[model samples]
Target: MADKVRVAVLISGRGSNLLALAEHKRRDPDRPYEIVLVASNVPEARGVVLAKRLGLRTWSLSHKGMERRLFDQKLDTVLREHDVELIALAGYMRLLSPEFVERWEGRILNIHPSLLPLHKGLDTHRRALLAGDEYAGCSVHVVTADLDSGPVIAQTRVRILPRDDADSLAARVLEAEHELYPAALERYAHELRGAIGEGREGGSDD
Candidate 1:
């Protein structure tokens, strides 16, 4: 469909969230997004294999020795080649350069393990547990130059049980992430479509 938002997903691991998004798209034929590509920095990343099995286009570019900006430029080129209109970072571990973040800006989204503004970096669940926090959750936010400091679009919170450890808490939060991410992506897709429509109408003044 001409109006469908073309999407690309970047992954560095198992791509659990990618699977969730793909399944959501499959279950809802009328969803506003079409997953056009899946790319990974690690050539042997399981996500690449999964994407291939799902019959989606997949690209693998090694970032082992390349500079961050150079690698991200390659990624940008691949996304553009696929005509991607939106990007979703699903379990992608690499920190993107400021230039890359600025290039995509509002068009890129990332799902972080913690409620965000709380645990900005890694080991979120363990950090929460160690701090004796009462709640833990996942957040979907627009990707910015700052790490996990972008504007939050959606979040799903889960109670921290008295008997919970990092692993258990992480498992529950991951489930929450799986649900929250797809919903957030759908919301963002609609917003993107509206913005494009507005821009087109504004340009019609010519």
Candidate 2:
């Protein structure tokens, strides 16, 4: 049997999406990806504690006052040390440096609260409501240097009720994210495996 794809999840807040992914792995023992590390830029992130409870290794490094590239370098070192093959960003608030994005490229994924190409940055729910959009949703995409601009792997939409406020709409999108992200990760993991197989086959002739 092939080894499971080693994954590292990065979080900055509640890590609800991280928990969703973990649950998915638990429910499906044959999942192609295994989360080996849960890392955060904030020491107080609740996800760290939950990850520890789940018997996964956890790491924290404060991004405060550090240059973006410098912080990302440290993060890169940590991920490499753990032999992480893929990275998932769940509510990880900070933007990664271009260097980091380039290094990971196709192996990094992020879940954004909006449909993407619509509301790219923060306050997505409020922006969608203010724009009078009929529907709001979440998107799981490959991470890129261009913020939320990446090839979307999966999405789940929710109707925006007329009475919905930022909080209510955000809650709806959060639910969608929890559902969509895990499915996206699973799909991507399969794709990654195929790509790796192709790479190895191509290298055999060398």
lDDT of each: 0.92, 0.91
Give TM-scores for every candidate, taking all chains together and pairing residue i with residue i. Answer: 0.97, 0.96
Per-residue lDDT of candidate 2, residues 137-175 (tens digit):
999999888989999888888999989999999988888
For lDDT, the strongest prediction is 1
Residue 98 in candidate 2 has what lDDT?
98
RMSD (Cα, Å) of candidate 2? 1.2
At residue 27, give the lDDT of candidate 2. Answer: 99
Candidate 2 segments whose C-alpha is farther than 4 A from its true place: 204-206
Candidate 1, position 64, lDDT: 91
lDDT of 1: 0.92
User: lDDT, candidate 1, residue 138?
Assistant: 93
* lDDT against true structure, model 2: 0.91
TM-score of 2: 0.96
